[model samples]
Target: MMNYHKRFHARMLFALATMAFPAMASAQDIAATTAPASQPQPGDENLVYEIAEVAGIVKVASIGMDPIKDAAAWRQVVPGESLGRGQQIRTTFRSKLKLVARPADPPTVILLENSSRMTIEDLAIRNGAAVSRLGLGYGAIRAGVAEGGVRSDMQIATPRAVLSKRGTDIFRVEYMNGRFNMSLSEQGRGLLQAIQLQLSNRGDVIGMKSRFVTPGQQVTHRMAQAIESMTFDRDININDIFGLVGNDKLFTMLNDRGFGFLLPFNGASNNIFNGQGITQGEDGVAPFNNGLFNTQSQGVRSITDGNFGVGQGSLPNLFDIFRNRDTQPAGSKKSMNEAMRSIFKPKARPRLNIGRVRR
Candidate 1:
């Protein structure tokens, strides 16, 4: 007679089923008058970590600033949920998350994506090592550090930058599309695995130019019109840009309209970054046209991502992507990031000063 509602939902199926962060059932309520604070009261012993892996759409709020009055105050961290220390994990619009701070030996994985917001400021065990300290606060994270025999002190803090465990294996921080992402790779010869990001913005730590990132390899940062020196595009070789989009037909019409992650077998080689080939305005060097692998020099322009526009005469134009499939945006993810932000959005030339015309 022990079925306790299917054993309490098999202990809440241990978090990570996937897809379900589309909360907008109309938000208009916020009058709790400082009353909601107990996202962990059902025997929460500050357990630390245990939501192993989740895919798409997630929510958990043990807020740190206090002020909740809607979205039923977010509460769903199935999968043996046990977290601790002011939790706050979120992922909406094509969600993906994985948190396994420690299952045994040397495991520490916390990969989140899609409109993210992470927090777990400190998980202890210090003096004996294992001192994770996260706080992304915005979006994008990928910290997978295994090779442990014991002794780990992971740390990621970003308002601008601060990622620790410097010997490096894998640790990421992102809040891009606005730029300021940065990769720290000194490894990789012929990538089949990629996670290269380099975006930039400056404010603190002397507006960070480069603050020692080389534990494993994969960094991204640039913006503020690219100040330059992220190691000159880290040797620019994503399989030489997928050997220059090998299988043509406009690369299968942009891999049948997902723009095959913009290029390269389309997975940053395979470390799974997805896409990014931007370089715009004011001589946005190599905005996919540094002789784009010279595709037979049969010129014909019009490549846009500044907001949408594509032309590649003599071939590409592939019927202009059905001219607007009835105002897209279904299944959200802003219609796959507006076709991955106009397939690597970067169409420059807007750096004006009104200078010379000296004939």
Candidate 2:
């Protein structure tokens, strides 16, 4: 039965690929083959953050070292210890971390919810003010700026979202498994634009594409200029787009993998968003606006009275997984696996659609 399902999924994906963006797929292949390798990243200057507080099981490791499961790596951190550039910070199940960005004008505070990972990308500080950028590899992070915290320059980029603010504001970005060059994403608060870059297997850019998204919009990524998907995506009226968009690579990938990737692009009939239109956690906490764990489970669902195995009838289906993810206790390890993994490997080439996009 399991094997039958797998074959069915593969066939469905192949059919969609052919029916959707046959032309773009071919172009993507050519672009990928002809693209150059990514250039080496230069070593950045040293910048640092301090651990303001920690909840259950937060782990800190350097980008330069192997996984630190030994007591030493876990014990090395004290509240004032410096977290330099190129380091990774993670929180285990039921854990939260508060980090203070060093030397900032209005001061900056970063909160990492459970099952999240972040990397320090760049930091430039002078005269008690700092410009620090961090990449949210996956999971959720909320950045806080002081009142009047608007910095014309602060930027946050995620696999699916790029957020910037003209004034001091609080924002959150969750990365649920996307592999793409983030540098091409623009920086700003109003109507963030997307730059779709087609990359070679070696991670070099060969071609590019784009779109415009309103505040609170989510965009997924794919390789090449699969004009097929990009084009049809734009035809949906902007207002209707929210209700009808987003049946791209992520949807296929999740449906196949059984993590319940079929989301309500048809609008918010799903209970995930509440009557007031604010996202609610299992605890029924509405609006992840303020707190360490506000959006911790953003891409996950809760599993109540069931489990999400390939068959064991544990989870029964995807929606059940969503239930577990939303209601599960914070830092619950079992619930963690119920989240999305960045699974769009282009070699097998999930079918893509590039519809003609009209502004």
Candidate 3:
């Protein structure tokens, strides 16, 4: 009899690897052969921007480290026009951000200049559509808890597509063949537009390949051109692309390693929220959000029951051996019963015993 438990684990790994293989294999296909960040191409411009909002009287800070460590810093970034479309840009604090203590650089504050509030509903739509396009139905796990959390912290990217988020704002950041499209909520859109304008004024031409819109567009060239013209006036790095869009190469490499990577495209590192959902245990199915160990055990027992092994035969019990650890005394009735039972038990005998019976 083969060990079913071992087989099950093997199958699960095969499934995970099989699913991840294409994503990793595809990473190699999208490699970029370019000079290091130190050297800029003919028209390459360094740019940076930060998205923040104001609430009540004080400024709640949200900022993170520079995504690119050695990349040039935008010491002289120019600000663009404030997104003043009547509605009050409530740069209110949405949630507390996760921070790591660093010795070299201390934490910075996040300032809300003119930004809007983004909702979860807006992002759910685009995530659903994107999964649908990949021919994958929205399962409980889609945007739900992954092996790590309630959702995959993964920011999927293709030559023409990107799905990422900051805080509650999920942005469908896309750029295909020089066309750019960004899908976010009203608040997210306003912030993105502001950042785009800031980058354009700085002579950053990358935004021309992108646009910030809500999801559901069939993707058009006109929209791409319009996005391309939306520039920033700051020194932008390869890392700052996230505020408006993302660089395809950076996304692919991160996906290959099966780790979550989100960066502050703008200067407001405090605003960059990168929690990869909820974490279950090593079981991958166990979640930390609602239930604990007992819940996980019950779920496991349900899956590995009677039908999982041989029919009619019980599963092997490790504790059974310990049941007879303290043997009965020599003359005890229990010992006699055990000894007699073994002796009288039918042994494996030949099917036919004929010998001298005929005599």
Top candidate (lDDT) = 2
Off by over 4 Å in 2: 1-47, 68-82, 126-129, 146-152, 155-168, 179-197, 208-214, 222-359
Worst 10 residues of 2 by lDDT: 237-246
Residue ranges of candidate 3 with Cα displaced over 4 Å? 1-152, 169-182, 186-224, 227-359
Write model 1 residue lDDT over 1-359, tens digit each, in one string: 44565444433321111112121110110001111222333432233677776766688876653325656767667765767666677787787777776445456666788888777755655455666556665788876666666666565555544455543445566765444364543451111111112222321112223334443544444432243634465533222222233233344435444543444443222223432333332332222322233323554333332213232223333333434334565565567557655755788867565887445
2 or 3, greater by lDDT: 2
RMSD of each: 25.7, 26.5, 27.5
In order of appearance, the predictions have TM-scores of: 0.22, 0.41, 0.16
In angstroms, give how far residue 27 of model 1 lies from its true place: 35
* Candidate 2 structure lDDT: 0.49
Full-model lDDT for every candidate:
0.48, 0.49, 0.28
- Could you tell which candidate, 1 or 2, scores higher by TM-score? 2
Comparing 1 and 3 on lDDT, the stronger one: 1
Better of 1 and 3 by TM-score: 1
Residue 101 of model 3 has an lDDT of 13
- Judge candidate 1 against the unseen true structure and give its global Cα lDDT, from 0 to 1: 0.48
RMSD of 3: 27.5
